[model samples]
Target: MIDGLDPEYLDACPAPNLAAMAQRGFRVNGNGMTPSVTNVNNVSLVTGSYPETHGITSNYLLDRQLGEEFYMESAEFLRAETMFQRATACGLRSLLVTAKDKLRRLLSDGATVSISSEDPPGWVVSGVGEPPPIYSLEVNRWVLDAGRYAMSQEPFDLVYLTTTDYAMHTYAPNDPESARHVTLLDEGLGAVLEQAPGARMLVTADHGMSDKTRMLHLPAELGRYGISARAIPVIKDRYVVHHSNLGGSIYVHLDESSDLNAALDTLRNLDGVEDAVSGEEAAARFHLMQERVGDIFVLADPSTVFGDPSEVAMPAGLRSHGSAHETTVPIFGCGPGLDTSTAARFRQNLDVGRYVFEDVLPPRPDGLLS
Candidate 1:
């Protein structure tokens, strides 16, 4: 999966290899699960379910009892089974290669081999040479190169490759750098196709990137009315260079003394807030984990973001995601089993995993096959 790929990027940038794959097979516009952030959608892709089932509502979570924050990057946080685990139960080997270690940790439950560019082992370094810095565009190429090398060494029944979104976050669709990045990805994809001649190829994105011009601190806004709260940006991660811990959606945790209705009304009337709803309403509408979410969910307009109150000045040329606007993603499938008729069934990004697990190699009712 391409981390931040969108339909506009594919259309504006020249990626002949990907275009050919879409032409030879089928290309359809599919929606991603909301809030459209990396961890939420990536987990949904692997688990073939929504956050309600997988229990990963955000990339970061708050422990209200302990008043501590932690990254939701561990496999233990997942409540649903992954496709890789199911494949293993079926006597099949799966390989997972990702640009970020967080994803490697989150989706490596039942993989025969798992590697990440962020912390490649000595063997991976030897095979692919030294990897580039995770913040650079070359790092994504390194991930694909490593995956190609691994596939050549051993046969894997299922192979999953995911890249980072540094280029997408830094460059606009019309920029020359964006075109170069797409070309690099195309070349890497072609190499993978050559290595596995008969393997089916499915490509999709975790979320789409959007240019954000405004940043809102919901907590500070509520403070004007003597309300105490904390606004957690759902897209916040260790990679601050990509987004500066700003995103289009935020979870507002109100103090016990705050008036919930008043806070919700104030947030809805904010300049950049597109929609504000109670936590229960948000969970039901978005299929999220209710307990993991906050007291209120606030969605910003496409051009705005949510950040800390101290972050008064918006970062120049900042691009981020985590809102309904980014739900639109392109889904491409090629090879024998996938055709126009089959592609018609895919309405969301998670459908890709469902197709592989339920349609391609479903679990037998009896038990593990010999």
Candidate 2:
């Protein structure tokens, strides 16, 4: 999975390798889960399911009893079996190489070989050498390098490679920096193809990126309507340098004295607001975990992002996701036993995993014993 990779950006950028894959195999637009957050879709991609099944509906989770927390980096938040764990159960060795250590831990289950570009001293394996600096733009390249090294040392029946979205979050699709990073990513895929000649490879993203300029201070906005609400951006991370916690989706938990319908009406009238719904409606409509969502859910228009104004000021020119606008991403693959004949029938990001396990490999003699 490539983080924050938008299909629109693919058209603007030059990725000859990916373009070649389209010619040799198939490519189609895949729908990410509603609210289009990272943690939700990554779990979906691994489980061949949606947030409702995997129970990860947002990048930042809020449990009323435990307060709010970033959900993107934790495997404990995942409620379903990962493809790696499933493959391992079927007697297939699995390898997961990721740009972030968080994903390494999240995808690692059932003794799978897991390595990260963000590794510390003793965390990495022997053959898959140390990675480059995590903050560098070359971090994604570092992940691919580790994958190539690991593949050379031994063979695995299943391999998962995921990259960071630092470039996609900070640069426009046609910008020099973004182009350079994408070209490097494409070249890395070419190298992977060389190492595993007959391997079935599927490339997809957790969510797409959007250019959001205007910022809405949601808490303060709710205050104007005599509503006490905690407006939490659904997208947040420890690495705030890129997005500064501003995103297009916000979960609003109303205070005990506040009127829910009044706050929803006020939010719906706000400029740049796309849609606002009650928690129950949100869960049913978006397939979210009802208990984890707030009293009200807000989606910002494509040009705007929501954040707490009290947050340290955001730097100029940064892009972000975690919105309804970033739902469609490019999904494509090539190799023996990989079927693209039904490409037109493709739907959600979960289909990528379903295709790999069900079509590319031998089905479990009976049912998956998960």
| Backbone clashes in model 1, listed as residue pairs | none
Model 2 — TM-score against the truth? 0.93
Alpha-carbon shift of residue 66 in model 2 (angstroms): 3.3
TM-score leader: 1
**Regions of model 1 farther than 4 Å from truth:** 311-313, 364-370
In model 1, where is the ten-residue run with the lowest total lDDT? 361-370
TM-scores of the candidates in the order shown: 0.96, 0.93
- Displacement of the residue 224 alpha carbon in candidate 1, Å: 0.9
lDDT of 2 by residue, 1-370 (tens): 8888999779888999888877777889878888877677877888787677777777677688876455556778778778887776677788888887767776677536787777733534455455666666788887887788778877888888888888888788888888888888999998998888788788889889988778988789989878888876788766677688888898899999999889989999999899999999999999887887889989989988988667667558868887889988998877774456767656778898777657655555457653
Number of clashing pairs per prediction, in order = 0, 0
Best by lDDT: 1
Clashing pairs in 2: none
